[model samples]
Target: MKLKPVRFIFFCCFPLSVLIFLSAVTKKKPVKEALNEPGDGILLIKNTNGPTLGYSNKSGIKILSIENLYFKDLNKNGKLDKYEDWRLPVDERAKDLSSKLSTQQIAGLMLYSAHQAIPVLTGPFGGGTYNGQPFSAGEALASDVTDQQKDFLLKDNLRHVLLTSVQSPEIAARWNNNMQALVEGQGFGIPANNSSDPRHSTNGGVEYTAGAGGKI
Candidate 1:
């Protein structure tokens, strides 16, 4: 009644294989938990397998947890929307968001704002008023958003902003954060897409027509 070599090896490995499979089936990834309290300004939720999420508590946005991963509830809805889920492809998320926008919101998204300057310059090119007075009147900080900027952001829902100048780098950063916070609290939590003119050298002597190929 001697067992063959192949049968003996199979018998020896059968129980061990079953045990390994059972252990793997029972194992699960541990969920990580983090609490974001009010007044935290901007909080970062670190993820081991996904994107790091940044949300401002002051913006009325909330953190949502799904299968141990955290996402931003940008629209403040309790349920997670496709755009708010980072796991999906960017094109899918964008399509989902586009389907949810209203006519006015879509129109606003298409609008490109005029040139804006941080602290609002006093000159004719990019000048603006703070609380109905010029920036040099000493009524507003250099980082403050001008009244005109606020009107375009809130009333017109304009998200595309063209920036021309800033008082300083620090002031520019502060103004940018302030503007983001303002818009993040608005509809759909859409942040402003700000652009600036080229800050480096320019050749004033060179000019070209729209249809021309080379510089004149």
Candidate 2:
């Protein structure tokens, strides 16, 4: 049987619904507000190991503070579920999440988006359009979301994306943040996993072939 994400309804005077979020990792328990940028989609908490955890505010994801530790609420059910707890085995968490997804979501999970270029273009390789026009037809950033990207993401429900082009590190970072925020407000708040072909170049522990004059 297909499973559905748990959603809640608030009977406030204006009928308000709350989104939940959780920090992927956190340091000591939060005694006071260390970071506060409430309306922005995601919140960042400092990790003891030096990396910050980001969670969306609109997606109903929040950081649960325990005896000084922070946690992520991946399913956004107002509490930290098994899948949200990083301390557990990843396989266990994945199984829990897998059981909560609907059939459509599972189909979406199976789909893989084609090669995409950040700030899509009108070129020969990995070219795309803005709205219906080329990226340069008007002033569009390399990080601007193209029409095809939106269609595949929402209509096709494809979460996996392969990025082929990036203008700079800064542009790529901004694009990633924007993409996460956009999808965070969507159906089940599952984040996209953007990837690219691995470019591996290693010459370590190689032997020289004197006959071919090559390193292997």
Candidate 3:
């Protein structure tokens, strides 16, 4: 059947118009303005449809805004790096980060640090000194980073830290923040991967149950 010219053109354009309308309606909205929260030495960037990014202002890191979303300028190059973009896959991000590291930096990552204790214990095993004085001398706060720790973090580029005895949860949190700020300003801005040995002593009498979570 042959249709009139005007009616045929209208019918052909109607389907295309519907598709365009649907595309416009389904398109994602751009992110809203970041809600900035500045506390202690950290700045938190909150977005409606994006990841929240927290960075230490003292660390010399800056924020990179792309497509109304925020990202940390970890290398401080004033641009978004692949590793710094949270949208990328984990393996892709790891590859991008590994490519940026030098041989020495890779070696440093391989090196696992000795057991460290928060508040710098006086015993020989996990003990550390602040400045030249032991932590027991009351010369420094329990959260203060030891001179030895600073040396390893900066000079040796050590990213892995083994935390042994944390004096208190509060003290441990403060110490972690301090350490993170220290390395966030350095090359590639890699934060410390702090770990601890099994701190919870299990009861011999209790039987293990699958998917039963227990407090530490």
C-alpha local distance difference test of each model: 0.74, 0.65, 0.78
- Residue 146 Cα positional deviation in candidate 3, in Å, after optimal superposition: 0.7
Arranged by lDDT with the best first, the candidates are 3, 1, 2
The superposed Cα distance between candidate 2 and the true structure at residue 27, in angstroms, equals 16
Encode model 3's per-residue lDDT on 1-216: one tens digit a residue. Answer: 466887989999999999998887766434235646566677777855777877777898877766556788899898888999999999999999999999999999898777777876665666778898888889899889898899889999898997766777778888888899999999999999887555344442222221112121
> Which window of ten consecutive residues has the lowest lDDT sum in model 1?
207-216
Candidate 2 deviation (Cα RMSD):
15.5
> Judged by lDDT, which candidate is best?
3
Across 26-142, the per-residue lDDT of candidate 1 in tens digits comes to 653342345443332666777768777766656787677666677878888788999988889999999999999888888888998887777675657567898888877898898
For every model shown, the clashing-pair count is 0, 12, 0
User: Model 1, residue 45: what's the lDDT?
Assistant: 73
Q: Of models 1 and 2, which has the larger TM-score?
A: 1
- Per-model TM against the reference: 0.72, 0.63, 0.74
Clashing pairs in 3: none
